[model samples]
Target: MKRDINIFEFPLNLGLKKKEHEIEPGVRKLPDGFRKFDFHKEINPQNIFRLDAPDYSMEIDQESGVLNAEGIIEYAKEQADFISENHKEDAFNIILGGDCSILIGTALALKKLGNFGLFYLDGHTDFIPAHLSETAAAAGMDLAIITGTGHEKLTDIQGLKPYFLEENIYCAGNAETDDDEYVQQIIHSDIHYFDLYELRKNGFGKTAGDFLKMVYSKALDGFFIHLDVDVLSDELMPAVDSRMDDGIDYTNLREILKPLVHSPLCFGIEITVLNPDDDKAGSYTQPFVKNLIQIIKNKED
Candidate 1:
């Protein structure tokens, strides 16, 4: 029997540590934006599941990095439980997130089953510490928090510190790492990493081969993938929350992604930060979706 792909939609802007006024708009439209295109035919996923958080009452206390919401943690717990008990056991999960912060909830779900690694493919390191950031965007600090390296409260989500073991994580395809602090944090930490230049220098196949080798050698139960579309350079596909120049282009992206998407070791895949507002002409949608389906077919064959 053919295997299955289960897609999850998380539609909310609540996860930010950044004040709403400062955040770039149109992220909340991601889920809605996705609906404009026909993924049902394109990717042909088995089922699409959506996880919705309760209406936001969250406020950020910038000094300490707390979200300042009473119910948000509980909401995350519920989302985690839903993924673990219902969807995870049955299908290959594809999560469409409002922002990278969705990792906080989904990673917890992956953790519940067994220890899992992360394949973070994005433009920014998103390794900034919450306390150090006044923008307060949880999206920026997701990788840090996921690895249990950020503010105490976020690191300890559900009492699961170091939600993902550093040795098991591979942060591939990060661009624009010039920020001294973000670079410093990643350097001091144990997460396996490859910058855009490093990945391209070796080519996508070798990078994927080396990355998977490193991941499988550790012998973790499974791993989840996080794809921030901003990792693509503006020339090919520019519809993103943030753009990174001189990043991977479409051809190399497919080459880099195919093996991993096809890898048996991959448990779940999440796509985030595709801002529909940026792509009003729908010029980039279908081909991008098609490439994703082809990525999966690499595994199927």
Candidate 2:
């Protein structure tokens, strides 16, 4: 069935540690930034929901050892509740994130709904323990938190620990393979891992096809996609918080996303880590907004 589209804007950016020169991460501007290029108008979503985020801060929680842990948990609960209240089975949700940490709330909401698979596409694995994190930012280790590998406070929200099973997730497009420790962490986990080199070697379309097979084989209730724009090459999209050298291009992006976006059991996608503050001229964001709309619009056709 072709599902209608719904957009949810959660502009919380507290998950990131403020850089030395900047006041805070600028990911919070993502939703409005896309709208500036007519992203929302082209999709013409069925409904629009937005949750205003708290002002940015860089406090490290003593209890969880994560930056802004308390604020992240607070917003995550509200995000889950908001999504639960307005969720529609037949509508595809396009969650515009404040950062990668927004997955925590959506994971919680999906947990309440039923077992869900996750297709994680990012420039980093995001599967490190808090102790190993250089920044102590939740965005750096969200995959670990959601999979019950962190402090109980963030991982076990309301006793729903392990929002997503390790084996049920497919983490693709990691470019940070230079660090053995960082690479080894996710390698030890059950999530199916595909670094950027391996992703291209296997072929983007085939990699996505393989993930779909897993979703069907597991008979999951539905699945959510996490898209961190840094997965695109620095040449193509360099407006992200962390810029890696080489990554996929727009053609490769559509090759991977089209099948998944059009799938019947797919829930929706969340876009993260695109800092509009860096792309003041909108050169990168313009093409991003255009290609993404076409990918979604093709689903209806």
Q: Judging by lDDT against the true structure, name the best candidate.
A: 2
- lDDT by candidate, in order shown: 0.72, 0.94
Candidate 2 residues lying further than 4 Å off, grouped into runs, are: 299-301
lDDT of 2 by residue, 1-301 (tens): 2589999999989999877878789999999999999999999999999999998988999988999999999999999999999979889999998899999999999999999999999999999989999999999999999999999999999899999999999999999999999999999999999999999999999998999999999899989999999999999999998898999999999999998998988899999999999999999999999999989888432
Candidate 2, overall lDDT? 0.94
Residues 1-301, model 1: lDDT tens digits: 1458777787655655333554434565676666667665556777777777555545775544656423445656777887876684546777887777788888888877788878888887887776666566677778887787666666787688878888887787788777777678887888777888887887878877777887778787877889988888877668776676767777787787777777777787888877666777778765666666667656331
Please, what is the TM-score per model?
A: 0.89, 0.98
Using TM-score as the measure, which candidate wins?
A: 2
RMSD of each: 2.9, 1.4
